[model samples]
Target: MRAIGKRLWMATLAAVLALAAAGCGSPASNGAGQGDANSGEPIVIKFSHVTTPDSPKGQAAEKFKELAEQKTNGRVKVEVFPSGQLYGDKEELEALQAGNVQMIAPSVTKLVGLNPAFQIVDMPFLFNSREAVLKFWDGELGQKLMKSLEPHGILGLAMWENGFKQFTNSKRPLKRPEDFKGLKFRTQAGKVLEAQFKALGAGAATIPFNETYVALQQGTVDGQENTFNNIDTQRYAEVQKYLTVSNHGRLDYVVLVNKSFWEGLPEDIRKALEEALKEATEFERQLAYELDQKSFENLKKAGMEVYELTEEDKEAFRKALEPVYAEFADVIGKEFIDGARALK
Candidate 1:
C-alpha cells in the first residue's frame, strides 16, 4: 500500500513539472516569442491619400507597397488607398491619428491646424525650384520641423514633392498682381494662404480638395491654385479658361505614420521599410518633374490659355504679397521663417 501511494505522488509531481516547462516555452516568454504569435500573418499597413492612382503621390504609394512587401519577404503588407477612397483631404489626418489607418501623405498645408509652423512650406515663393525645396527638407530645419509632430502622436517620415503651385482663374489672365483682386479663390485651409490672397486684394475661400473642381465650375470661386499635375488630373482646365504658371508656392506632402504603430514595429521590419521609403521618395520626385512637364503640355492641348510668368512678373507678385511674411512671422516663428529663407 505504501509503495503504490509513492508511485502516485511521483506521477503527479512529473505532470506539474511538465506543465511548468510548457509555460516557459510559450509565446509570451520574450519579444521573439511575442512575434511568434502572429508569425503566420503579415502585418497590414493601410496607406491612404487623396490623389488618383496615376498621380505622383499615388504611384509612389503603389511603389512603396511593392518594395515593402519584397523587402520584408511578405512580413509586411501595404494596402494603398488613393483618390480619397478611404478618407478625403479633411478626414485623413483624423483617421491616421485614430489608427483606423496606418499611413497617410497629406499636404503640408493640412498640418497648419496641428502646428502653425508647418505653414513655412506654404509661404509664397519660398522655394524657387524643386532642388531648393529638397535642400530645405533634407537640412537641419526640416529635421526639426519633422520632430515637432512627435508630441501629437504623429511621425513625419519624409517630404514628397507635388511640384509648384500655379493659378487658374475663369475671370481673366493673371499676369499682374492686380489681376487677382476682387476675385475669390479656392484655397486649402490655412491662415498663410488666406493672407496670401488677401495681400493681393483678393478673397480666399477654404475648400476641400475633392470639391475644388465643382466649386470652380459653378463659379463659387473665381480661381484656385495647385500644381500643373493636379490642375490636369482634376480637369480644372475644363472650367477655368486661363492657366498661369505662377510657381508662387509649392505643394508638398509629408509621409506620415501613426507614432505608436511605427514605434511598435519589429526593428528588422522598421529598418526595411525605411530603406524602401528612401528609394520610393527618390522615384516620386523624378516622377513629379516628368509629370509636371507632361501635364503642362496636356493642359495647353486641352485648349486652356497657358501663360508663363516672366521673372519680372513673379517679382512683382512677390513684392505685393510680401506683407504675408510679416503677418505670420510670430505664428510661424521668426527663426523658422528665417531659416527657410536662408536656404534660398
Candidate 2:
C-alpha cells in the first residue's frame, strides 16, 4: 500500500508539471503563445540622420516614424536617430548598405559618390524650382537613377525635400561673387559642391554635418554652406553669424533601406511600406520650403546678420561657378547633364 501511494504521488507531480509546461508554451504565456491573436510582431528599426529634430529633415523623419508605427498598427517600431547619434552621412550610408542600419536619411551629395548618375541631381543651377525637381525625380529619369542604387544592396524608398543650399559663416555675409573670397567653408563629401566652392575662391573642406557644430565651435573651420532648414535645425545660429541667400545649391534628400531587409518583407508589409513612404515624401516636400523661409526669419531674430544679394550679385555668383558644370561634366556625363537641363 505504501509503495502504491508513493507511485501515485509521483504520477500526480508529473501530470501537474506537464500541465504547467503546456500553459507556458501556449501563446498566452507571452507574445508568441499559440493561442495569441497577434498575427505579426513588432520589429524595432533604427533610423539615422545628420540633423536636429527641429530641422525640416529632422521633423520629417519624426513624422515618418509616427506614420510608420501607426500604419503598421504597432507591428513595426521605428526609432529615430536624429542628429547623427548613430552615424554621419557616409558612415550611415555604408551601414545601411551592409544591413547594420535599417534606414537612413542622406542627401543627394552623398549619393553622387555612390553612383555617378546621382550627379544629375547635384548638377549646379539645374533645377529652376521645387516643382521642376519633383517632376524630374518622380519621372522616369528619376526612377532610373533610383534603380542604380539597387546594385549596391540599397533600396531607395523615397525622396524627401531638404530645401536649397545657401552660404553661412562667422566671418561675413556673402553679398556678391567677390564676397566669397578666401572664405574657408565646410562642404559635403561631393565633388560637384567642392568644385563650386573652389571656383568661388573659398578654401573648401569636407566635414560631416554632425561634426560641423563642434568643428566650428573650436575654430576648426570658418563657416559652412547648407540649407536654411539645416542651419536652423543644427542651431548654426549659435555658432555662426552671417547667412547669405545665395541659394546656390539644391538639397535633395533620400530615404533608404537595406535591400535584403526590404526583399525579405512580406508582400503585404512591402506594399504597406511603399504607401507609407509616398505619404511621408509628399508631406515633407510641402513643408520643406516653407520651413526654410521661417528659419531665415528666425535666424535674424536670433541676432544674426542676413545679406540679401542683388540680382547683379546673384548673376555674378552664378557666372563665377559656371565652370563647375563643364569641369565635372565628364564625370557627371555630358549627356546626363544636358538631358537634365533640357527637361524644362
Candidate 3:
C-alpha cells in the first residue's frame, strides 16, 4: 500500500512539471524563444555599406546606428560595417537578401538591374541644385520609387545624398563638350552614364570602383567622374590632373533594410528607426555640400586645376546630350522624365 502511494505521488508531480514547461513554450513567448516585449533578449541589427566612415553615406550610417540604439532604450543594437568591411558594393545587396545583414545603403545606380526606374536620378543634368533633388526625392515620386523595391524583399528607408559628380582627366582640361572627344573615361556601370559620355564624343569604360585609381594611374583609363568628396577621400587627385565642376549628375544612396526583418520589428522599434532615419537624412544632406566645398579646397591645395562652367558653356554641353533623353525614354519612361523635370 505504501509503495503504491509513493508511485502515485511521483506520477502527479511529473504531470504538473510537464504542464509548467509547456506554458513557457507558449506563443506569448517571443518567437524562437528569443524574448518578449517586457523582458527578453535585445534585438540586433547589422548594417553594412561600401564607403569610408568619414564619407557622407558612412557618417549617415553611424548617425542612424547611434540614434536607433538610443531611441530603443538599449532594446535594439545596430552594428555598422562601413568601407566594405562586411561586404563590397556588389555583394552587399545579396547579403541583405539572404538575411546575413539587416540593412544596406547602396548607390542608386546599383539598383538599375532590379528596376530600371531607379536610374531616373542618374539622368544627366536632371537636377540643377541640391534643393531640387531634395524636393523630388522627398515627394510622391521618390516614395513611389522606394515602394517599387518592396516586392524584391527589400525596404528603402530614405534617400541619402553623395553630392554632384565632377569630371577629372589626365589628358587635358575638359572645359567644353569637344574636349571629351577621343578621351577614355571610366564610368559607373549604368547605361545612362554610358549614353551621356558617348554623346559627348568620349569613350566610356565601366570599371569597378576599387580598381579605378590604379587604372587612372597606369593610363588604363584617361579619367573618371565622381563627387568632390570621393575624389578627395580616395585621393584620385593624386593620379588625375584637372577637375571640372560638371555637376552633370548626382550620386545618391538609398537606405535599405531586409523587408522581412523590417516588418517583423516591434512596432515601437520600427517607428523609432523611421524617426531616426529622418533626422539622419537631414544631417547627411546638409553635411554633403559642406564637405564637398571643403574637399574642393583640399584638392586645390593638391594642385588640381579646377574649372567651373559659365551658363553659356553649360548650355552647349546640355544641348549636346539632349539626344540621350530620347535614347533612354523606353527604359526611364518619357512621362516619368517629364514629371521629374516638372518638380519645383
Candidate 4:
C-alpha cells in the first residue's frame, strides 16, 4: 500500500509539471507566426539607401521606422542603413531582390534598368510642378509603373519626393542650355538623362550618388545635377563651383520591397507597415518642401555662385530637350509619356 501511494504521487507530480510547462510555452509557441505580436522575436526589416540621414529620403526613412515600430507594438523592427552603409546605388537593388535587405528607396532614375518606362519621370520639364508630379504618381500611371516591377521580384510601395533637380558643376554657370556645352556632368544611369546632357553637347558620366562628391573633387566629372537638399546635405556646393536652380527634372524615390518577403509577412504586420508608410510619405512631402527651401538658402550662404533660371531660360532648356522625348518614346512607351504629359 505504501509503494502504491508513492507511485501515484509521482505520476500526479509529473502530470502537473507537464501542464505548467505547456501553459508557459503556449503564448509564444502558438503565436500566429514568426512576426506575431506575441512571438518572442520581432520581424526585422533592413532598409538601405544612398543618401545622408539628414536628407529628405533619409529623414523619412527614420520616420517610417518610428511609425512602423509604434503601430506594430514592437512586433516589427525597421533598421535603416542610410548613406549606402550596406549597399550603394549600383548594388542596393540587386541586394533587395536577393533578400540581402528588405527595403530600399532608390531614385526613380535608378530603376530605369528594371523598367525603361520609369525614365518617363526623368524627362526634362515633363512635370511643371511638384504637385503635378505627385498627382501623376498617385494616379493610374503610378500604379502601372509599380505593377511592372512584380516580374522582377520587386514590389513598389510608395513614391517619395526629393524636390526638383537642379544643375551643379565645377565648370560654369548653367543659366542657359548653351552653358552646358563642353561640360561633363555626373548623371544617374538612364538614357534620357544622358540624352539631355548629350543634347546640350556635354558628356555624361554615370556615377554612383555616394561617389559624386569624390568624382567632383577629383575632377573625374565636371559637375552633377541634384536637388538643393542633396547638394547642400552632400556638401556638393563646397566641391562644385556653380549651383543652378533650374528645376529641369524631378528627383523622387520609389519605395521598394522584395516581393516574396512582403507577401510572406503576417497580414496584420503588413497592414501595420502599410499604415506606417502612408503616414511617413505624407510627412516626407512637407519635409521635402521645407528642406529644399532651407537648403537653397544654405547653398547661397556657402558662397557657391547660385543661379535661378528665369521663365525664358527654362523655355530654352525645354526646347533643347524636345528631341529626348522622341528618342525615348519607344523605350519608355509612348502612352506612358503621353499620359504623364497629360497630367501637366
Q: TM-score: which candidate is best?
A: 3
**lDDT per residue as tens, model 1, 279-325:** 99999999998998899999999999988999899899879988998
Residue-level lDDT of model 4, residues 1-344, one tens digit each, is: 99999999999999999999999877442112334445677888899998889877899999999999999989888899999899988899999898888899998878888788888877887777777788888888898999899999999999998888889988888888888889899998877888999999999999977798999999999989888888988899879988888878888899999898888777898999999999999999999999899999999999999888898988898899889988988998988777777775
Per-residue lDDT tens digits for candidate 2, residues 1-344, read: 99999999999999999999988775431211111224444665678998788766787878878887788777677788888898976599888876667889788767876787686665656765667777777876777777889989988877888777777888877787777788788877777777877888888888876799988888788898788877887898899989887656687888888887777655775677678778878888888878888888888898888887676876777688888887887887776666666665
Q: Compared with the true structure, what per-residue lDDT tens digits does model 3 show for residues 91-210?
A: 999888878888899988888888898888778877767788888788888888888888889988899988889999998998889999999999888888899989999999999888
- Evaluated against the true structure, the overall lDDT of model 2 is 0.76
Model 3 Cα displacement at 232 (Å)? 1.5
lDDT of 3 at 35: 40
- Report clash pairs, candidate 4: none
The better candidate by TM-score, 2 or 4, is 4
Scored by lDDT, model 1 comes in at: 0.87
* Comparison by lDDT, 3 against 4, better one: 4
TM-score for all models, in order of appearance: 0.86, 0.75, 0.89, 0.82
> By TM-score, how accurate is candidate 4?
0.82
Candidates 1 and 2 compared: the better one by lDDT is 1
Ranking, lDDT, top scorer first: 1, 4, 3, 2
| Clash pairs, model 3 backbone | none
Error of 2 at 207 (Å): 3.9
